[model samples]
Structures are given as structure tokens and as C-alpha cells.
Target chain A: MELYLIIILVLMILGSIYSLNASDLLSAVISYGIVGFGLVIAFLLLQAPDLAIVQVVVEVATLIIMIAAIKNTQSKIPKMEFKPKIAIYYAITLIAALVFILIFDRATGCLSQFGADTMRMAQPYIDGAQHTKSANLVTGVVFDYRAYDTLGEATVLFTAVIGVLTILRIKGKKEK
Target chain B: MIIYILCFILFLVGLYGVVSKRNLIKIIIGIAIMEYSINLFFIMIGYIEGGTAPIITKGFEHSKFVDPLPQAMILTSIVIGLATTALLLAVAIRLYQKYGTFDINKIKDLKG
Candidate 1:
């Protein structure tokens, strides 16, 4: 299982790198899809089928939205000229990323090991899920224990849809 | 674990794309990639060895289940990601309509 997870992680990393470096927007988007699928597999391997389902659906929708946006525009990225200053910027970013990673590693070193049954906060929810009469523990947590947060999430999605409509709608009056 | 480190590297790659890329759509894709990496990391944190899915069935007796809190949280995050991606695409399309090009450098009318 660990080996499978490692392989999936490597594939995801490769997909991200390819998407970032692709010369055309379409190829980049395709590679991004690869990364998304890799993530779905990883979620399954981690025993989070609920997340896998949601992620797969969301990824498909995101890809469709992106493709629609790109269909009417230029899809090719203009070639970039390499500059000495750009190299310096890359070096700086690399050093900063390394330092950030080291700090994160050190900070999380005291946490419980992977797949260890040491999550105290979740124990209550797991034990009480039966009383909630929900077959899926995740559903119980999302809809019962944390229903208010879900309501807020629904509100956020509604607001985003309204904002998108307002931004993309064509105005009747043209100033030109 | 190595998984966590790899996830962070994926995030950094996405950050590089967002910072260095001049195209608006590519930047959106980078943001999406970063979002995926974070979601994956959260799910990984909740994994338990020898654990089954959090769904309870009638016939099976299971003592161990993966943490469901992160799964629920990630579900909400994924939906939010979809909404944000849709909104960003709408904005990108609008930008294209106004500027006639997707290159950020050339679409600098507001530059002082």
C-alpha cells in the first residue's frame, strides 16, 4: 500500500511539472487532468472514497470550465526569453522553498505517525456515529455534527455563482 | 513521511507556475494544482493503516476506520474549488474579450 501511494505521488508530481512547463495551454490542461486523476487514486488508497468521489466530479467540472474558457481565445503560450535576472529569481525561489520545507518537516515531526490511531478529536465522532442513524460516518459528520459549516459552504457557492454571472454578463449599454 | 514531502514539492511547482507564468489561464491552473496538493495532504494525514472506509455496513464487523473529518472537510474544499475555478474562468474570458489577447504583459492599460 505504501509503495502504491508513493508511485501515485510521483505521478502527481510529474503531472504538475509537465502542466507547468507545457508550451500550449491545452496540453497543460490535459496534464493537469492527469494530476487530478492521480489525486483521486491517492484518495482511494488512503481509504477516503468519499473524497475520491467528490474530487473526481469536481475535477471533471473544472476541466470543462477551463476548456470552455480557452476555446474562444489563443491557446498557445508565447515563448519566453531567458534572462540572467530570471535565473537569479529562480535561485531565490529554490532556496526559499527548501527552507520552507525544512521548517514544515520540523514542525510536523512531533505529530502522530501516518495511519496511527491517535486522532483524539475524531474518536468521539466515530463512536457516536451509530446513534446518528447515518450509515456513512462522513455523511454524519458533514450533515449532523458540522451541518452549520456545510450550510455556510452552500452559501459561499451561491455567492460565487452570482458573482460569476454578474462578471460575465454582457451589459446592454456600450460606452464606446 | 516521504508522501508529505512530495506533496509539498508539488505545491512549490504550482507556486512557480503561478509566479512565473504570464498567461492568466495558466495561473488559474497553477492555483488549482496547489489546491489539489493541499487537499491530498489533508487526506493523507487522516489515513490509518488497516482501516476500512468510514461507511458502516450491516454484515461486516470493522473496528478501524479512517478519520472522516478530513474527508468531509475535503469535500467542502473541493466544491469551493469548483466555484472559484468557474469564477476565475469567467473573469479570464472577460479579460480576453476586452484585451483581445491572453498575454498579461500586453494587457497593461491600468498600469501607472
Candidate 2:
């Protein structure tokens, strides 16, 4: 399964590169659409069904918005040519990111090795908590150990809504 | 695992697009790619080898089930991603209306 996913990832990367190089707007859009769908499948294989579903939905919405934008703004911007040797730049950045992640994952694995410890500590609490009955450990974590965080998250969303309203200035406008 | 490395590569590809692509739509796609990569990473963390789903059935035992916590976390994250994508799309649309173009390179009014 992992090997298959790796192959798919490689193919997706190649497809993205091809899309990047394709001069046609429609092909680029199609490539992005394919990538979006591929990501949804990858998310499910990685055990994130909820994310997969939501991502697919959001991606469809984004594709629609992008198509609309492209229809309105149809021409490429004529500016300094993209002659920064993108291949070299991407290769270097990819290596740097991979090294960083590897070092961090390895170093964190060495330091304290507290993942199991944290789980062990939380185990009794988790088992004892009535909230676990909700069938969502994340919700338990959210509303129990970190109820304050949940409140803050809710506040952030509320603030975002207000911000959107302020920006729209649609005081009497019908809700969409 | 190889899966993880590939996911990281996918993430790098997306990040590269985000940094190098000047088109607004491409940048948005890049961001969406990054979002999916993270979601994939989170889910991978909870995967158990040969482990069954957490659903409890009449004949099922609890010992073989994989951890359910990450699944729940992913559920919340997915919803958050939805909200983010919606907000960003709204912003992108407004940007198009304001500037009449999706070329970030041409947007010079906000430059410092």
C-alpha cells in the first residue's frame, strides 16, 4: 500500500511539473483538478476520511472559483520572464525541507521519547473521562484538557465572520 | 516510511508552486495542495499495521482496533480546512473584482 502511494505521489509530482510547463490555461486547470482529486484519495489512504471528503468538496468549490477567475482574466501577465532556474531552486528547497524534517523527526524521537509517556499519562484520564463516551477523543481533548483552546477557536471563527461582514459592508443585503 | 517521504515531496512541490507561481489561482492551488499534504501527514501518524477500524461490533474485540483519537482530530481539521478554503476563495474573488486581474505580479498598489 505504501509503495503504491509512493508511486502515485511520484506520478502526481510529474503531473504537476507537466502542468507547470504547459502553456495552455485549460491544461493547467485540468492538471490542478487531477491533483486535487489525487490528494483526496491520498488523504483517505492516510486514514483521514473526514479530511478527504472535506478536501474534495472544498477543491471542487475552489476549481469553480478559479475557472470563473480565469474566464474573467484570460491572459498571462507579461512581466520579467520566470527565468530563475526553477528546477534547481525546487531541488534545493526540496532537499532542505526533507533534511529538516528528517532531523526534526529523528531528534524528537531521541529527546525524552515522551510520546508514549504522554499517552500513558493521558491514558487513565482518557479511560476515566465520561467525554470519551462521545466517541471522539479529539473532542475529549478539545473540550476537556483544552476547553479554553476550543473557546478561543470559536472566538476566532466568530471574529472571522465579523471581519467578513465588515469587509462586505452588506448591512441590509440578503444572506447568501 | 516511503509514504511519508512522498507526502513530504508532494508538500515541497506545492510549496514550490506557492513561492514560484505568480498567478493567483496557481498559488491558491498550491496552498490547497499544502493543506492536503498536512492532512495526509496527520492521518498517517495514527495508522496501525494490520489494525482494524475502531468500530465495535457484536463479535469484535477491542484489542485489535487502531487508535481512534487521530481520526477524530482529522475530522475537526477537515472542517477547519473547509472554512479556510471558503474564506480564501472569498478573498480571491474580492481581489479579482478589485484589481480586475489574477496576476499577483501586476498588483503593485499594496507594495511597501
Candidate 3:
């Protein structure tokens, strides 16, 4: 199982690198889809089927949006000259990665054991699922314990849709 | 332990793309990649070995289940990511309309 996970993770990383460095926008988007699919597998292996479903749906939506954006635009980025600025960018990236890894290592200390009840807050939900009358504990927690947060997320989606519509709205006067 | 480290490395790759790439759409893709890595990491943190899905069934004994909190949190995050990605792409489209190019280097009229 661990070997399968490592293989998936490696594939995801490779897909990410390929997408980032791809010469064409379409190929990059396709590679990104590969990365997204790998993540779905990881979620499934982690026993989070709900997350896997959500991820796959969102991944498809994101890919469609990106393909639409790229359809009419230039699909190629011109080659950039290697300069001091590019070297500085690389230096910054290295420093940032190192600092992030150090802080993360110190903060987490150790990875929580697999199949362990790591979150105290999750206990109540697990214990209360029967009383909540929901077959799915995740759904119960999302709609019952944290319904307010779900409401906020809905509002955010609403606002974003409206914003997109307004932004993409065409002017009749300009058309005339 | 190693999984988390690899996830973080993926995040750094996206960060590098955002910092080094000169194209607006590519930058947006990088941001999306960073979002994916973060979401994956969160889901991984909640995983329990030998755990089943967090669903109950009739006449079945339940032993262990994956943590629900991170799953819920990630669900919300994924939705929010979709919204933000849509907005970013809309903005990218508008920028292309106004500037007639996706290259960030050429669209520098608002320099301070």
C-alpha cells in the first residue's frame, strides 16, 4: 500500500513538473489533469472517498475553464533569455522551499499515525452520527456541525458567479 | 512523513512557476497547482491506516473511519478554488481583451 502511494505521489510530482514546463498551453492543461487524477487516487487511498468525488468534479470544471481560456489566446510562451533576474528568481525559489520545509518539519514534529483519531473535535461527530440520522458522517458534520461554514461557502460561490457574469458581460453599445 | 514532504515540494514547484513564468495564464495554472497540493496535504493529514469511508450501513459493524473534519474543510476549499479560478480566468480574458496579449512583459502601461 505504501509503495502504491509513493508511486502515485511520484507520478503527481512528475505531472506537475511537466505541466509547469510544457511548451504548449493545451498540453500543460492536460498534464495538470493528470496531476489532478493522481490526487483523486491519493484521496481514495487515504479513505476519503468524499474528497475523491469532490476533487474529480472540481478538477474537470477547472480543466474546462482553463481550456476555454486558452482556446482563443496565444498558446505558446516565447522563450525568455536567461538573465540575472532569472537567476534571482531561482535563488528565491530555493530559499523559500528550504524555509518552508524547515518550518513545516519543526511545526508538525511527527506525522499523525495512520488510522488514528488525531482530531479531538472529530470524536463528537463520529459519536453523534447515529443521533443525527445521517448515514454519512461527513455529510452530518458538514450540514449539522458546520452548516454555517457551508452557508458561507455557498455565498462565496454565488458572489463569484455573479462577478464572472458581470465581468464577461458584453456591452450592446460597443457592439452597435 | 515523506508524503507530506513530497506534497510540499509540489507546492514549491507551483510557487516557482508563479514566480518565474511571464505569462498570465501560466501564473494562474501555477496558482491552481499550489491549491491542489495544499488540498491534498490536508486530506493526507486526516488519513487513518485501515480506515473505511465515513459512511454507515445497515447490519454492518463500524470500527474506524477517516477524519471528517479535514474532508469537510477540503470540500469547502475545493469549491472556493473553483470560484477563484473562474474569477482569475475571467480577469485573464479581460486583460487579453484590453492588452491584446497574454505576456505580462508587454502589458506594462500602468507602471508606477
| Regions more than 4 Å wrong, model 2 | A18-29, A75-132, A135-176, B109-112
Tens-place lDDT per residue, model 1, A1-176, is 98898898899889888888889888888899999999999998998888888888998998898888888667878677899998999899989999989988998898787777866778898888778989899999999999999999999999999999999888746778
Among the numbered candidates, top lDDT falls to 1
For model 2, how does the per-residue alpha-carbon lDDT over B45-67 read when each residue is reduced to its tens digit?
A: 66665554444345654444444
Task: Report the C-alpha lDDT of model 3 over A1-176, residue by residue, as the tens digit.
Answer: 76788899889889988888888989999998988899899888888888889889999999999899889877887766689887887787778789999998777766674445676768888889878888888899889989999999999999999999988888634643
User: Residue A61 in candidate 2 has what lDDT?
Assistant: 70
State the DockQ of every prediction.
0.84, 0.39, 0.73
Global lDDT of each candidate: 0.88, 0.63, 0.85
DockQ of 1: 0.84
Rank by lDDT, descending? Answer: 1, 3, 2
DockQ of 3: 0.73
* Candidate 3, CAPRI quality class derived from DockQ: medium
Q: Encode model 1's per-residue lDDT on B1-112: one tens digit a residue.
A: 8778888888888888899888888899899989999998888888889989999897644668888898999899999999998999899998898888777887886445
Residue-by-residue lDDT tens digits, candidate 2, A101-152: 7974674453332112223333443464454564444455556666675676
DockQ of 2: 0.39
| Angstrom error at residue B25, model 3 | 1.1
Regarding TM-score, does 2 or 3 come out ahead?
A: 3
